[model samples]
Target: MPTALVTGAAGFIGYHVCEQLISNGYDVVGLDAMTDYYEVSLKEARHARLESEKFTFIKGYVEERDLLMGLFETHKFDLVIHLAAQAGVRYSIDNPRSYLESNIGGTFELLEAARAYPPRHMLLASTSSAYGANTVMPYVENVRADHQMSFYAATKKATEAMAHSYAHLYDLPITMFRFFTVYGPWGRPDMALFKFTKAILEGGSIDVYNNGDMSRDFTYIGDLVSALIRLIDVLPERGSAPAGETDSLSPVAPFRVLNIGNSSPTLLMDFISAIELATERKATCNMMPMQAGDVPATWADATLLTQLVGEIPHTKVPEGVAKFVNWYRDYYKC
Candidate 1:
């Protein structure tokens, strides 16, 4: 069996990735910090569900160079998926240091280890927030995204640059994918779907940011996982990009960035209505202004993703929301 190392293995997306990898007959090593950003128990519960002989779990921060180097020395990882990072746009404003430590510092550590013990392909997680302040309807990979609205996005962008330099110098095949508002079962509590579900179930009010005027290209977790698995095989080759393609392939390095999203921006209110339909409960709305370090909208171009993966995410908002609601009710016995 091929060996793969997945960071943030306890996170919402990471857990699903590990599950899919194990099911496909891969020996997976999973690492998670189990941080209390939202609820550590929720992450623990997700990890617990994946316990098996094929899945090895390690609890530690990826920023720890010693821990990461030790793991690299022991296991010859064929593929390295770096999903662990400090996530959240709003939280980054209050705690910029955390983002620096986890997003920038941690990624540097991973790159160094990968240099010493190279993996076949290294995939890193980036956010659509990195497209900060861009008015582009559907964000394409080739566009310049230097104007980041949040510290979170800035750090993620930095990692993209950092990864590219390593790829150029060491010939490490690296692919960085920017995710656009990922949601589904086992989602994070800080996200809109999870918070709205809990509030609606408890008959509490949900905070509708930007007075429900915001929009997002909410990619379903299952669809995102499928895209990721496909990308693992589509490694970047130096100077091999086809002509006339909007490829973000680095001219001097085997590195590229892809945007993985639904490509359909749904209104915030419609997303809330999906929750209401799923839960059969009317939400008391607290229409609030857009929070600091938040964009009013986000949509992905996803042309490159389709060109590479041969498929696109097509999960409709209502259908995906219904699945999350069902999982929440069953998991919490609500």
Candidate 2:
């Protein structure tokens, strides 16, 4: 079995991705710092659930330059999935340096490590927030993302550029996946889905940001993991460039950026309604103005992803929300 190294294997998406990889017969080495970004217990619980013979756990921060380099030297991994970062839009405003350290510096460290021991392919996590200030519906990979509202988005965008440079300079195959609003079982407490579910279940008011005018391309966790697993084998090449005739693929490096999303922009109220249906409790909406560093809507143009994987997140809101509710109720002993 090929060995895969996952940077944030204890995170919401990282846990799911690692689980899928282990199920698919990959030996996964999980690295996580167990940061108290939201709840360390949640991360621990996710890691505990992934206890398998094929899984190896390593406790460390990604920003540890020498440690990460030493790890790459020790394990010649077949693939690397970089997901550790300072996530959340609002949190970025309060702590901008965290984003710089984790997203930018951590990525630089990973690239430096990859330089010594190159993997077949690397998938780095980028967020739909990187599509900052773009009014265009269904954001595409080729879109010029020059304007970023939050420091978080800026750092993620910077990672994509940094990864591309590494890909070009060291001939490292790289894929930058820009994730949409991913939600499901093991979802982060900071995200809207988790917060709304918890608040409504406890008979509290749910904060409706932007006066409930916001939207997101809510991709289910399972479908996103399936897409990612399929993409593991479709590695880009350094010399074999993508045809430039209206193609979004990178020209200089063996690197490509893809939007791993549902290709559907869901209304904020609609998402809340799905949660309400699942929880069997109406959410008391506290209408609030749009917070700083938040966009009104995000849709993904996943044409490239569809062509590559022959699949995309098609699970409708009701179905996905119900699954999450089931997991939440069972896990929390509700």
Candidate 3:
């Protein structure tokens, strides 16, 4: 079986990706720090569901170069999925050091390890927040992204540049995934969906930032995992971008960037309505001004992704929200 090393294996996306990888017959080794960014119990529960003979779990920090180097020397991973990052946009405002340590230092350590034992492909997670300050609609991969609004996003962007340099110098095959707002079952409690659902179900008011004026291209976890799996073999060659297409493939390095999103932005109020419908309750919304390190909206242009991997998922907001609510009710027994 092909061996894959998945960092952040206990995280929301990491857990789903590991489960999918194991189901696909890959011998997966999952490494996670299990940081108390949110609820540790949720992370542990996700990892618990991933127990399998084909899966090996490691609880540790991604920034530990010695630990990562040891794993690289031992397993010779075919794929390295780096998703272990300090991940909250607002949280980064007060905890900038954590972002630097996890998102920046952790990625540097991973790249250093990969230089020694190169994987077939290294998929590192980026965020739509990295598309900072750009008011362009339908974020295209070829569009120049700079002026990040959040420290968390800035760290992720930093990793993108760091990985690119490593790719150029070491010829390391890497694909940076600019993920839109990913949400579904086993989602992070810090996310809006989870917070809002919890508050609404508890008969409490939900904080509606920017007076609920924002929108997001909320991609479901299942869809995002599927997109990732499909792109695992879509290796980037220096000059092998599809003909007559706007590709983010680097001209000098075997590296590329792709946006994995639903491509359909839903209004904040509409998302709230979806949750209300799912929970069969009206939300008492507390309107508030936009917080630091937040954007009013985000939409992704998945044309390049479609050209590479056939059809992308288009799960509507109401449908996806319902699924999450169902899982939340079942998991929380609320």
Candidate 4:
């Protein structure tokens, strides 16, 4: 079996990716810090569900160079998926240091380890927030994202640059995926879907940001994981751009970046309505102004993702929201 090392293995997306890999007969090693950014029990519960002989769990921060180096030395990982990061746009505004430590420093540590024990391919998780203040609809990969609205996005963009340099200098095959608003079962508590579900179930009001005027290309977890698995085999090579294709392939390095999203921006109000309908409860809305480090909208141009993976995420909001609501009720017994 091919050996794969997945960082943030206990995270919402990471857990799902590990499950997918294990089910496909990969020997997976999962690393998670189990940080209290949310409920530790929730993460523990997700990890507990993946208990299997093929899956090995490690508890530690990826920024720890010694620990990462040791793991790389011990296991010859064929693929490395870096998914652990300090996530959340608003949280980065208050605690910029955590983003620096985890997003930047941790990625540096991973690059160094990969340099020593070179993997066949390295996939890093980036956020659509990296598109920052771009007003362009359906953000594409080839466009220059120089203006970041949040410290979190800035750090994620910095990692892209850092990864590019490593790929150029070491000739490492790297693919960085810019993820849109990912939501589904086992989603993060800080995310909109989770918070809204909890509030509606408990007769509490949901904070509708931007007065419910915002929009997002909410990609479901299953679709995102499927895209990721497909991308693992589509490694980039140093070459000129393909004719009439906006491939983000680097000319000097075997590196590429693609957006993995639903490509359909849904209004925030519609999203809330989906949740309300799923739970069969009316939400008391606290219409609030847009928070700091937040954009009013985000949509992805997933052309490159389709070109490479041969498919795009097609989960509609209503169906995805219903699934999340059912899982939340069953998991928490609400």
Off by over 4 Å in 2: 241-246
| Residue pairs in candidate 3 whose N, alpha carbon or C atoms collide under 3 angstroms | none
| Candidate 2 weakest lDDT stretch, 10 residues | 241-250
TM-score of decoy 2: 0.98
lDDT of each: 0.93, 0.91, 0.93, 0.93
TM-scores of the models, in the order given: 0.98, 0.98, 0.99, 0.98
Better of 2 and 3 by TM-score: 3
Model 3 scores a C-alpha lDDT of 0.93
TM-score, candidate number 1: 0.98
lDDT score of model 2?
0.91
**Model 1: which residue pairs collide?**
none
Candidate 1, residue 76: CA error in Å?
1.0
Local accuracy of candidate 1 as per-residue lDDT tens digits, 54-119 = 999999999986888889989989999999999999999899999999999999999999999999
Candidate 2, clashing residue pairs? none
Q: Give the range where candidate 3 is weakest over 10 consecutive residues by summed lDDT.
A: 237-246
